[model samples]
Target: MSEPLPWYKHFWPWFIVVLLLGVIIKSLVALNIAIDNADSLVSDDYYKEGKAINMDLRKIKQAKNLGMQFLVKVEEHQLIITQHGGPQYKAALQVSFIHPTLEDKDFNVNATADGTGAYRIALSNAITGPWNVRLEGFDNSWRIQQRVVINDDVEYWLN
Candidate 1:
């Protein structure tokens, strides 16, 4: 009869050990990645931000009262914005493209209205994924917000 094999030489034990080690290594890698890529979306001054909600609400109310609406279209690298009904002639409009994840990717473009209610601004760079667009009068009297998922080109209306 052959002598009994040592536990280390057993196939089942070694297989179990290897499987456990692989799981442990994978878990460690995932934990390291989560720690390294910490993306915090909350502002440092959250209290002040919370207090400012009332002001934003007032601006939104003003926009509603003024019957403000916008038609935004993105083509190539140009952003065309048409005011459906608002101030007859706005000197300047503040358009902000806010990236949901990366703050550094967020950018603001100031557009001047033509004689008509149409405004056009050239975008220096193209953006991908989801973005929160905020449009407000330069004086902050009225504001409109819209969320868009931009793949190639998009057009939408904000009311």
Candidate 2:
């Protein structure tokens, strides 16, 4: 009879080894992805933040009582905001752009009104996707927040 082949030289052992290696490599890749892209939407201090909701609502109420309205538009890299019926705010407006999922992508811009409630500021880059925007007075006495999706051609109304 012909000599039998050694286990290391056999086809079955090599096939089984390759399958295990593939699973191991795939698991390593998945682990790397999970570590790098951890979730950022949850707040660490849930109790404190929850208690602060009423304060935020009070600010919104102040804005509403003052009849504040904003018309927001994005033109190229410029963000244009016009106040409709707010007080003659002497201080600059602070517009916050909060990314829905990624905290690093959030930013703020300050724009001075042109004596006619018209304000403009240059954005660092083009922004897309969903966002939570907060428009606050310079002293933070009044504020309004809303969720908006960025589109180059769309106009947003905030109150």
Best by TM-score: 2
Q: Rate the local accuracy (lDDT) of all candidates.
A: 0.85, 0.88
- Residue-level lDDT of model 1, residues 11-128, one tens digit each, is 9999999999999999999999999888778689999998899898899899888889898888888888998876564668899999888888999988998777579988777666
Clash count, one per candidate: 0, 0
Candidate 1: regions farther than 4 A off: 1-36
lDDT for 129 in candidate 1 is: 79
lDDT for residue 15 in candidate 1, whole number 0-100: 99
Q: Top model by lDDT, which number?
A: 2
RMSD of each: 3.8, 2.2
Off by over 4 Å in 2: 1-5
Quote the lDDT for 103 in model 2. Answer: 89
Model 2, 1-159: lDDT tens per residue?
999988999899999999999999999999999999988887899999988998899999999999898989977788888877777676788889999778899898887987666888888788877999899998888998999998895789998
- Quote each prediction's TM-score: 0.72, 0.85
